[model samples]
Target: MSTATDLAELTARVRAHLALRHPDSPIGDLKTLPGGHSGLTYSVTAGDARYVVKAVPPGQRPVGRNDVLRQARVLGALAGSAVPVPAVVASDDRQPAWFAMDFAAGEAVEPVLDAPEVPAGTARARMLEIASVLRRLHGTDIRTPGLGAPEPLDAAGELARWSRTLHAVPAELRPGGEELLTRLADALPSDGRQPVLLHGDFRLGNVLCAGERAVAVVDWEIWSVGDPRIDLGWFLLFTDHRNFPHLGRAVPGLPTEAELLDTYRDGRPPLPAMDWFRALGRMKMAAIMGHNLRRHREGKHHDPDQERLPPTIAAMIRTARDLLA
Candidate 1:
C-alpha cells in the first residue's frame, strides 16, 4: 500500500538520517526492500558501500515502538557474541525515524524453504545453530543501557496481551480463535523464573541462510527480554506439520522437540513450564494469522495464501489442545 510519494519521502528521510550519522560516507542511490507489513526497509548504496535502513511509518508511528533503534541496540549488545546478528553501523532514534546498518549480502532463506534440494539435515543443523544462538542471547547479562529495560512477561501477562490482541481482531474472524485463546488463558503456567532476552520472532523466514548455514538474523522488531521457549514454540508452529502433503520431504532441518529443548536448556535448570509456554505460542500464532486473514477478508490487504489459513489455524488449535491434554 506504499505510494511512490511515500517511498520518495521515506528515501529522503533515510538519506538525511544516514548523512547525519555517517557524514563521511557518500551515499548513492536508494532502493526499497520488499516483504514487510508493518515497517519500511530500504537498501542503499554509498560510494560503492551498501547499507540497509529500517524505519517505522512516518505519521502513524507507534509510541515506544522503534524497531530500527531496538535492532541496532540488540546488534550492538550482541557484538563479539556467538549470535549471528547483523552489525549496526549507525542508529538514529529521532524524528522522521530510521536506523542504518550494513546490508547483509546473502540471499534470503525464505524462497528455499520450499525448495526440493535443500536437505532436511542441513535445515536441522541451521535450526540447531539458531537455537544455540538464542540460548546464548538469553544467557547474556542484560544490564546494558540503551537496549531498554528487560520486560519478561509471565504466562498470565502473555495470555493477557494475546487475549487483548485477539479481541481487537474483527468479529468475523473470531469463531474458532476465541476458544483457542480461552484454552491458553485458562491453562497458563505459573513457573519460568529465569528470563533472558528473546528474539520474539525466531522463524526460518526471518533468517538469511547460504546453503546450510545462517549468515544473518533479520527482523528484530519483536525482539525483547522474555522466556526463550516462546521462540522455540513459534518456530515449531511454522515449520512442523503433521498434515501437510509434503511433510516427509517438505519438513527438513527440524529438531525433535526433545532435541530443541536440550539445545535450548544446554544443562541449565529445567524449564518446568515449557509445555504451557509452547501451547501459548501456538495460540499466539493463531491469533496473528486470524488478524491477517481478517484484514484480507475486509479487502484491506491481499494475500494469495489467505485461503490456506483456516486449516493452519485448525492445526494450531489441535496442537494446543494436544499439548494441554
Candidate 2:
C-alpha cells in the first residue's frame, strides 16, 4: 500500500502484491508506461503473465476525484461487449490508489494524428475504423449489470454542471465562457432519444490503434450516459476549422465532419442539431481547461505545460462562440 518513487521499490512492492494474490507468479522486467496527463502506469511481467498497473499519484486530486475505481468498473461493465477495453485484474483505493489490467500492446492514434500527410486511402480507412468502434460502443446495452444505470441528460443539466465549475475560473476568463454557455443553452437541441452510454473523452489520443485497427479504448474518467451525438460532436469539433485552423495543414488524414457523422450514424437516424452539440463540446473543453488552469495556479498538480492552458482556454471559448454564430 505504500507509494514507491523508484522502480526498484515499485518492483519489490509488485513482487509482494503478486505473492499474496498470485502466489505462483514471480515479478520480472517491470517498467513504467508513458503517455497520460494524470495517473501513473506500469508494465510488469510475472511468471509469463503480463499486465498493467494504473496508479494515482500520491497527492494529485483530479477534477472529480481520482477515477481509477470508476475506470475499473467501466472495464468490468464492457466485459462481453464489442468495445475493446483492457481486462481489469485487481484494484484498491488505498495509499497509491491503483488498479491492474491485462496489458494492451499498441500505439495510441495520437501520434498518427500529428502526421503532416496520410495517404488518402489510409486516412479514410482509419477514420472508418474509429467510427465503427464508436458505433459499437454506443450500441452496447446500458441496462447490462456491471454498467451503471443510465442517467438522462439535457441542455440545462449540462450547462449547470459546467457552470458551477466555471465560476471558480479567474474573473477575466469568465465573460467568454459564460457567453458561450448562454448561447449553447439557448440553442439546445430538442432531439428526443433515450440517453446512451457516452465515451466522455472520445478522441484519437484516447484510443490505441494497432495496424490501423483500434485495439483498446483507454481512459474512462469521464464516461457516462448522455446524448450519443455529443461524442461525435466532440470529435468533429476538434477537426473543425475554427477550433484549430492550422491543424488541417499541419496534420492530414482527419475525416471531415460530414464523413465522420455518416460513418457513425451508419444509416441510422440522423443526428439532431450538430452545431449546438459541437458548441457544447467546445464549452465543455473550455471549462475543463479553465479548471485545470485554476488548479495550476493553485499548485494542485504541478505540470509545466499547464502554463500554456490559459490561451488554449481562451481560444476554445472563442471557438465555442463562433460555432454558435
Candidate 3:
C-alpha cells in the first residue's frame, strides 16, 4: 500500500464499493484526504455529490477504534439531533467495515488554535459555542450508541481501559503511569455523576469549523457513553498551556476554563468532581501518546508527528499529578 500502484488499487476498490450504493450515479475517483486521528479517511466524488469514506485499513481488524461502522452508527444517531455531525449516508459490514458520510465543508482546525498563519479572532465565541455543543452531545440517549446494554465507565474503569493500551508501549516512556493509575483508581468520584455520551478524544482538533462556528464534530473512533467530565476536562486542558503541550501557548484568545464550564452547565446542576476527571483525562492522553509513540518508533506506523509526542507523555503525567494534588 506504499507505492503509487497500491494507492490506485485501493482507490479502485473504494470507487467500486461505493458504486453499488449509488448505482445510477456517475462515481468519481477517491481522493486521499489527510489528517485524522484514526481510520482511513478519503473524499470521493460522485456526480455532483462529495462523500467522505471512513474505512478500516485493508489488512487490519475492524474492531475497537478501527471499527468505522461504530462511528457511522453514532453519527446516524446524532444526525438529526442538536449535535452537529456529518449526516451518515451508508454503511457496509463486509471485511474491513466502512461507512460514508457527507463531506463537511469546514476546516478541521479552529482559527484561534495554536498554529501560525491560521486566523485568530473568533476564539472566545467559538470556545463558548463548543461548550454549548458539548451540552447537546452529552444529552444524547446513551443507548443509541450501544449494540446492547451500554456499559458506562467511571474514573477507575476508564483508567483501566487505557491502562491496557499503555501496557503495549515501552516501559521507559511511561515512568509515572502506574502510580497515576493507582491514585486515580483510589480517588474515584464520590458523587456518582450520571453517565453521558462522551467524545472520548474531544478537543478543538476533533471539531470541524465553518468560519467562527463548529459545523460538525468528526472522528468518532473513540466515542462512548461515559462520565461527562471525561470529555469536558480533556477539552478544557487544551485551552490551558500548562497541560496538553501539543496545543502550545498561543491560546490567550480562548475563554478561560471557568467560562467554558459555566457555558456547558447552562441550567443543569453543577458538574461534580471535574478536577478528578481532568486528571484522568491527562492520564488518558498520556497513555494514548505513549502507545502511539511506541508504534511510531517501531515503524509499525511511521508518522513523524508522533516523534514529538514523547515529551507530551511526561507532560500529561505531570499535569495529571498536579491536578490530583
Candidate 4:
C-alpha cells in the first residue's frame, strides 16, 4: 500500500513503492497520465510489467466519480469480454487509495478523427469499429458477475439531474434550455430495456486504438447499466461537428450518422425511434456546457474556449427543439 499524499511527489514515490513490491524491477520513469478530472492517474512499471494506477486524491473520501474501486469493478467484470478493457491487477481503499490495471497499449484517439496522425481511412475505420464494439457491449449479458440486474432507467430522475445543472447556469448562457428540456422530458424514451453495462461517455475520445480497432475503452468512471440508447445517442453526436461548433468540423472521412447506425444495428432488432433519444443527448450536453461555461466566466475556472459555448449551447437547444417538433 502507498502512503504518499501529494500527487506531484508520486512520480518517484509510486515507482519506489512498486519497485519494493516487485524486487529488482520497474526501471522506467513514472508518467502522469492526462485528461482525468480530479483523480490521479499514473503510469508505473513493476518487473517489466507496466500498469496504470487510478486513484482517489490521497486522504480524501472517495465519492461519485472519485470512487476508483467502482471503476475497477466494471473493468474487472469486462476483462475477458469482446469489449476491450485493461486487466485489474490490484486496488486498495485505504488512504492513498488506488487500483492497478495492466497497461493496455494503444493510441488514445481524439474526438475529432481528422486530427489524428493516422490516415483518414484508418480514422474512418476506427469509427465503424467503435460502432461494432458498442453494439457488442450493449448486447453483453447484464447478468455478468460483479454487476447484477441493473435498475431500469429512471427517466424523470435523469432529466431532473440535468435540469438542476441547467438551472444553475445564467439564463443567457443556457438559452432555450427550458423549452428544449420540457420537450425532451415529455418525449423521453421508455425507461425499460434489457439493461446492459453502459460506457456512459462512449466516444472516439474515450477509446485507445491501433490500426482502425479500439484496443481499450479506458474510462469507466461514469459507467452504469441502463437504456443502451443513452450511450448510443451520445456517441453519435460526435460524428457531426455542429454538436461541437467550437471544435470545428473535420468530418469528411468519418462515417455519417446513418451509416454508423446501420453498423450498430446490424444484428439487433429493427431500431427503435432515435430522434427523441438524440434530442435528450443534446439537452444533457448543453446542460453540462452551460454549467461549465458559467463556472468559466465567473473566474471559478478559466477555460477561454468556454467563452464560445453560448452559441453552441443555443444551437444544441434549437436543434433539440426541432427534433422534438
Candidate 1: stretches off by over 4 Å = 1-13, 16-26, 62-67, 108-117, 170-176, 243-249
Question: Measured by TM-score, how close is model 3 to the native structure?
Answer: 0.88
- Candidate with more favorable, higher TM-score: 2 or 3: 3
Candidate 4: regions farther than 4 A off: 1-5, 8-21, 27-30, 111-118, 148-150
Tens-digit lDDT string for candidate 2 (1-325):
2244554555666667766767877677567776655577778877878888876666665334366777787899897679999988777665556778887886655423354344555555666778888999888788878777547665666667777777778867545877776787787777655677788888766777776777888888778877777787787755543464323233355677788888888898777778777877777777777778778778987776666666667777787788789
Give per-residue CA lDDT, model 3, range 202-234, as digits (tens).
877778787779999988887887778888978
lDDT of 4 at 115: 54
Assess each prediction's global lDDT (C-alpha) against the native: 0.69, 0.71, 0.77, 0.77
Winner of 1 and 4 under lDDT? 4
The number of the candidate with the highest TM-score is 4
Candidate 1 lDDT by residue in tens digits, 166-227: 78776555556666776776777766666677788886677777766777888888776766
The TM-scores, one per candidate, come to 0.86, 0.83, 0.88, 0.90
Q: Write the per-residue lDDT of candidate 4 for residues 287-306, one digit (tens) a residue.
A: 88888888888898899978
TM-score of 2: 0.83
Candidate 3 regions with alpha-carbon error over 4 angstroms: 2-25, 110-117, 145-149, 245-247
Better of 1 and 4 by TM-score: 4
